[model samples]
Target: MHRLSRALLRALPRAPLLRQPPGPGRLLPAALRPGSRGGLSTRPRREPPAAPQRPAAQGPGGEEEQFVFPEYVAEPGPAPAREPPAAPGRPERRPREKRQHRVTGRPDPSVPPSGVSCSGCGAELHCRDPAVPGYLPSEKYRSLMGGQPGGSEGQGALGRVVCQRCWLLVHHQQALHMQVSREQYRNLVSAALRSPPRHGRRPLVLYMVDMLDLPDSVLQDLPQLVGAGSNILVVGNKVDLLPGDSPDYLKRFRKQLLRSCAHVGILPAAQGTGGQVARTGSQNLVDVHLISAKTGYGVEELISKLQRSWKCNGDVYLVGATNSGKSTLFNTLLQSDYCKSKASEVISRATISPWPGTTLNLLKFPIINPTSDRLFRRQERLKAEAEKTEEQLSDDEQKYLKCLKKQGYLIGRVGRTFQQQKSKAVIEFDPDELSFSMEEEPVFSSNKPKERVEFTYNELKDARWFFDTPGIVKENCVLNLLTEKEVKLVLPTHAIVPRTFVLKPGMVLFLGALGRIDYLQGAKSSWFSVVASNLLPVHVTTLEKADSIYQKHAGKTLLKVPMGGEERMKEFPPLIPQEITLEGIGTLEAVADIKLSSAGWVAITAHLEDKLQLRAYTPEGTTLIIRKPPLLPHIVDIKGNRIRGSASYRTKKPPPLVENLKANGTNKQIKRVSKI
Candidate 1:
């Protein structure tokens, strides 16, 4: 059987192996058929037949042309080379086509560079849009930039120019409506507070709070914003607004401010021993001071303290909420001994106004280095001036002092040192400079002429600066909701004259259309002293007519503020009531103060045995604080005798300058001391 199988295999012709039978139209060699032996054969393989081409077509010129499809034709080219494998421990590189487009660090070219900004508000100077902040007329801007003499070799000339908005605010006492969001204001302050590593030391934060607006002016997150260990000096501004010069009352007021700070978590709460608590609090809170930034009452003392304690250790930052007088204080310091003599001559003053967000940038001046020689000279100068009587002062000094006295009884006059006075004449005058005298009192029309100056680049380099940061907006403040005209009437520009009234149970008191208070339940009639802006009118009526009176008189001439009439009333927020209960301490002393947003506060005085139930109303989204052991507990004494045949009392006027000096027992005596 094996011989027969071998003979059959040999007999088979040399044929190739076939996997399947051929179809009818296709043919295969007989040796390669499906029934043939499954053995390898030595025969060359044949190529498949090519597809047939279509017939040629006739062209317009009667020439023959063949149609060709590009997709079907294979291009004659070499294959692409593969990339080499990456080495061990190295990342594989991506192809150039797969890589993403790279971005650059250059600033946008579309935004025009600002070579100049408003010296008062620090807004970029532009003549493109008037509705925006920092807008200036085209002609005025061109004149300031190109026509001004003594160009200072570069952009330094721009620092001397103020925007149109600030110009109107300073000259005509008109405020422009510029709204700043709370987050943006906070960002500006935070940027000022953050010290770079090269600075070596943290800045001294001069945290200013408004005396009239208590807890509301105090920023709650101050400790968190500036580190917990930061050095803070709590400064109480606008003390002149209060009607008192007594040292004891001022001391009590300072304590009240410290308590408010503690309540807001800016300082540790007083506990255990009083002395120990104070010592512990002093670690973060270096000190607390009360000053009137407007009248310069305690600014000199504050400067002396700053020079002694801080002593040019680092930059000093002024931080506070809006309308806390940060800009006013900055302007006062710019012309004082706290600033370097050379820098003071060059730096322009910041804009001072009742409107919030007046300062929008970090306005700064070089801090004077407190060397031993400088301190000795300062002390000697102060001693000589203190010994001299009012007769010894210059005519200018006397006139300035006289004007300051009208603003506040306890006032300090800013004076220059011998060196500064001698150097002042050397400053070159620019013909095109806009000159205006600083207004002694915001309420008065008179102004003393003074030339403004600008700082050069060489003057500001590598110097420790005293920075004035933008004021943060208070969340619960009513000023945020008011118009510019309404704000002027609400915020005080001069000393506040206490207006007192006798209100029995079921009577109501209205502070313009902004605030309302009802004496709902009380045993006896109470004395309610309204410590508010003199411009805001006070009206008293029965509780039953309170709603009707507001409905009829709000936004009208009777209400005074929100002067647009019925149209303004439509946009104004409605009053919301907050019920409060208090126990009276005595008729002579106020038990508590009901703060109605920023409009003003009312000090409630009633019999010791009386239990008072009150309903305080403020605009919606506004805060109403009832403070115990009121800031001015004995404020009722500041008023005059009660008016005859009426529930109102005559407001007391500020005492004469001579009487105030004598009452305070000043060491220096004036020969020409007389009442104005």
Candidate 2:
């Protein structure tokens, strides 16, 4: 019956799962019922509980179901520090008491037995450490301390006793963590001595410089840092940011870098040519290499150098600025796995955020060489010491001090001056305040010029005056005078209106009465205005004694004021002569009014026929108004075009002496008559 029931259920399309079968096998045992206990019911007996229904067996097309289950993670707690047995032969020195003593033999207090000889004058050590007598912390002790200071809740609850020598040594080895003083930096021979790492020998030192920031001032002291024998390789690390991939562009960059170094005082390494090293004049004894850390392009060359040169597998110590990717390079070198087991370690005290200084007091590890056992060290310890010293010193000392103090001061003092230099201030007239008049109308020889719009006005009875008024504000407030390029003031967007000036032909305008006053030989005098006026392309006439001209020479030379109603010329007798001395030159009256009909125009004709060669008409192939016409000025064939006839002697206006010879004479005849 059960087999037949199962077979029938398998054939059904969508049947609800039953919790229990209404059969003898589905009933619970009699012992489980409270009614069966002692043949009496303690509570009313209920039907037996049904079993949980199972979902249908899943296949490729089955509806997937998920359920949240609590995960049980069994984390093994903090492991105890492993105690490696001390080496067999080398006897460990007994801890000595703290003692203060003078240093004599060696320059560096932290130098090993090998480098302890005096750099200044070769001498053997009298006291243990060269610079000072101090104790260094043991590797075991540093691990025990775990960066916890001698205070509450530390591994050393009572703070373990350490000698000054041991502590200094430990600090030197852990230079990456220590802040070195300026005194320490200056006195020490090598960075290693100041902050030696656990490694025994010097590693191939890579000196990375930000090309833009390196000044000769800072680079002068570079030789002292790495020393003479230690292979100091210089690398300009941001080559990727340089402009363009062209060989010429790269050459320019290299030349600029070399020149900048020379300016600040760094010598570069040997240059390569045609894929071979060549001796160049600018090459320094110090090796120089260019690389871009941003892209991992030249890093392999740097790694190859590190692998080849560093002795006793010396530590690859990268030292540079905060943003220089020192840590990134470090991580890359070590394949990013820092901890022996865990993914990351918690750094307690950080010099900077996100990136922390090396925390290991003396990170010791051993590597085997083909010949014997060796240790490869990455000495970030000295960098740590340098950082400490850097913090203690003023901020600019590392970067800008040399630039400001040495180069800036030198350049500033090279050319000294005692006498005050004269300065110029330009004066401009307000268009509204100006009034113009022409004594005579300008008559064109040709058909009325289509390019030039001409106008005429009556001559001025009084001498023209030009004034220098400062900028005007909306409230009638005037701002100080602004230079040509300067913006006087920012106006409210809605209130501001741009000004325009119109120049009319054959018109002389009286500006305001003012002249620029400047300093000369410490005295307030007008000289710059005089000198600068000569420099300006625009014609400017001084008005220092112009008023005298109105009193002296008014209407002397056929001057006339044409009234609108009469159109008559009124002749006046001379109050004074035409010439007067002011500023520097003995200036004469400008008989005719001046006007600029056009701002200026250059006719761009192609000469498509090629018959004229363009030169027959224009000397420059395009004419300057002051030099040639269709403008007023007479045209002289400067090139003297062989194809065209010699230019006629035509003048824009005849000279003042010849204006009276034939007032109605043609301009060409007037020019010829004046020349004769």
> Considering summed lDDT, which 10 consecutive residues are worst modelled in model 1?
63-72
TM-score for model 2? 0.25
- Each model's RMSD to truth, in Å? 35.8, 42.9
- For 496-612, candidate 2 gives per-residue lDDT tens digits of 011111111111111111111111111111111010010111111223333442233222221111111121212211111111112211111111111111111111111122111
Largest TM-score belongs to which candidate? 1
Q: What is the lDDT of candidate 1?
A: 0.72
Local lDDT at 298 for model 2: 46
State how far residue 299 of model 1 sits from its true place (Å): 1.1
Model 2 is weakest, by summed lDDT over 10 consecutive residues, at: 408-417
Clash count of each predicted structure: 1, 27
TM-scores for candidates 1 onward, in order: 0.73, 0.25
Q: Write the per-residue lDDT of candidate 1 for residues 438-520, one digit (tens) a residue.
A: 53322433455465554567756656788888888888789988877789889987667787877788888888889989999
